[model samples]
Target: MTHELGHAVHEYVSKKYGELGREKSCAQAETASIFAEQLVFAALLKAETDSKHRFILLAKHIEEMIAKTYRQIAFYRFEDMAHIERTNGEVSAQRLQEMFKSVMDNYLGPSVDTTGVEFICAGIHHFFEYDYYVYSYCFSCCVVNSLYEVYKSGTVANFAEKCMDMLTDSGVENYCSALAKFGIDATSPTFWQDGMRLFEQELSELETLEADIMKRTYINLEKKATH
Candidate 1:
């Protein structure tokens, strides 16, 4: 519901662009949705005082971000591998499964069993048809997280206004142009570096909070046992 509202807000802001506005890149299409959800998430995180509740919210948000960003990009690997195989001949279904399992193991790590990766990969229609489209999720995740960091850091003045301006120009501009006003170069390697840094920061906060919560729990249990 909240996610869809993000899309709706984007549509409303971009409607004036007419056909041009409606025709956006897949990554740009997802940016607003992720941005809006993160806005809501940040707000909820600020108000929550309970450690256990905060952990759950933080964990869920981080996990979903990973699934949306890393997992989706991992899926994009399948598209790349399949296309290369197509140069010689049609890739067999079994071969596609092999490629998917291989990629899955790389991302999921060696400890986890990926026994039926084929069945999981089969559920994604884009696996066979979309070519190289899944990268949009990764693209959006990076852009939104970077933009969110800017908002959090106060690096840019009047950011909300700038963000609104960018969204308004959605029909007329690509992400590179849209982000230029903020001094954000979507083409630069630093763009990805900044994004990963934000992710690492979030993960560090989660780790800190988890440690504090566990220590408090231990203290409480010790006090009760002594009593």
Candidate 2:
């Protein structure tokens, strides 16, 4: 609901798009939705007192982030290659499966055996829906994470207000210009890396929580032993 509300809010607040066309590019759309999600997640994290619950929340969010970024990127690559290969000739089902397996192997590395996972391509509806656009998911994830970092940094003055202004202007300004409102440079590789750091930060917190939970469990055991 929050994610949909984000999209609705963007369409409503952004005056530049007018009535005829009120939507952002794929990456831009995800940016708004994911940012709204971040807001909700932040509120939930703030209220939750249970360490285990906090760890679960972080773990789920990080898992979703990985799917949105890394997995989508891999899908995008497969689509790109599939499109290029299609021009040469009709891609046989077997050939497409082989292609899909190769792409997945490249992305997954040697960590997991993809052995007979060619069916994955046919299952993904996006591959049938578009030519090659899944990369936008990864792009938007990085962009949103980077923005969230800025919000948490305390360096930016009136960060939330500026962010709203930027969203309102998204209909008019391209991503580079829209992000520039926060002094974010999309051209810089660091901009994307900054976004990845959000994942890193969460994972670090989860690690700390794991240790704390384990220690508390051991201390409780010792107390029971004494009693």
Tell me each candidate's RMSD, in Å, in order: 1.8, 2.4
Q: List model 2 lDDT by residue over 101-207, tens digit each.
A: 88889888999999878898898887887555588778988999999888887878998788777777776677898788788999999898888998998999999
User: In terms of TM-score, which candidate is strongest?
Assistant: 1
Residue-level lDDT of model 1, residues 40-147, one tens digit each, is: 999999999988888888899889889887788789887788789889998888998899888888888989998997668788876556656688878888899889
lDDT of each: 0.84, 0.85
> Measured by TM-score, how close is model 1 to the native structure?
0.92
TM-scores vs. true structure, each candidate: 0.92, 0.87
